[model samples]
Target: MSRHAFFIAGDRVVHVANPCGAGFQYQAQSHVLSPRAQVGPQQHEAAETVLVVQQGALELMVNGAAGYVPAGSFVRIPAKTWFAYRNVGDVAAFVLCRTAPPQPARGARKITIQIAAA
Candidate 1:
């Protein structure tokens, strides 16, 4: 049996899954955020990401307009488009993230990713 590998990066918990060895085209991870926390502005050059919210609420900003994403809903973020999110509710947000055309793993170095003030 194989154990699931995961790590924390900045404010997000990243769950690493098998895509290459499992022969899947997309890579998958589960991410969690505390109330009022956010993640953003990064683009996936290789794949279009799909985010499914399993718990709490998310305020997703794409192209400068923010939309509310509720729990049990899914959103498709296109490749290379800059997007950001915020958890507006008072509960922890549980989200499932998947990227097609799975890119290589990111560096393990601890780094803070912040979007410039607009």
Candidate 2:
């Protein structure tokens, strides 16, 4: 098993934990979304995801339903559920995302899909 600690910087999504890097059962990522930036409209076929809001606010659209997620809050998205999020505050939004059973490495086998916006 590989184990190491690392730092994540910049205003982009960074995987903090993964099978290849940390040998963790789940994949953890740090996302820094600039104001008005959006992400997803995608679905995880076999992995459930949990999103923790660390700073700023976000508008989450899950399974076609929209809701507000403020700092210090979190949201769970079940497998196969379509989700998307956008920074709703003027400042950058920091979010910690974890997906269980770690998503397949890119090109291994597609377990995720990009869906059309509603």
Candidate 3:
């Protein structure tokens, strides 16, 4: 088995690359969101987040702004910017998420913030 080749298990979210797993400087993950499913309105304290839409569409709310990202498109969320995403299409959506500088070994610190209802 090559260190460069790895398989992600079938899960809602799977870490494909990480310092502990792939010795990467950044962390990469795969997310599968069912129709109408949604993620967090949270922000990373230090790492920047980049999301790539592989299939279906997503409605994104970032720092009080709303945007529609279609398949093949991507969005960047700077550190400390609150963001959330939902699958807008009537199918499963696939997303590839990358976070640079990776997260702290103890995990990211979750902060409480109010996001306007979308």
- Best-matching candidate per lDDT: 2
C-alpha local distance difference test of each model:
0.73, 0.74, 0.74
lDDT at 18, model 2: 48
Q: List the lowest-lDDT window of 10 residues for candidate 1.
A: 1-10
Report the number of clashing residue pairs per model: 0, 0, 0
Preferred candidate (lDDT higher): 2 or 3: 2
**Cα-based lDDT at residue 78, candidate 1:** 84
lDDT score, candidate 1, position 16: 57
Question: Mind giving the per-residue lDDT tens digits that candidate 3 earns over 14-107?
Answer: 3332446444445667789999999998888878988888789999999888999998887888888899999999999988877775454454
Rate residue 53 of model 3 by lDDT: 86
Residue 77 C-alpha lDDT in model 1 = 88
Write model 2 residue lDDT over 3-117, tens digit each, in one string: 2222233332333334464333456677899999999999988888888888999999998889999988879898888999999999999888777744554545433433343
Q: Candidate 2 — what's its lDDT? A: 0.74
Candidate 2 structure, TM-score to reference: 0.68
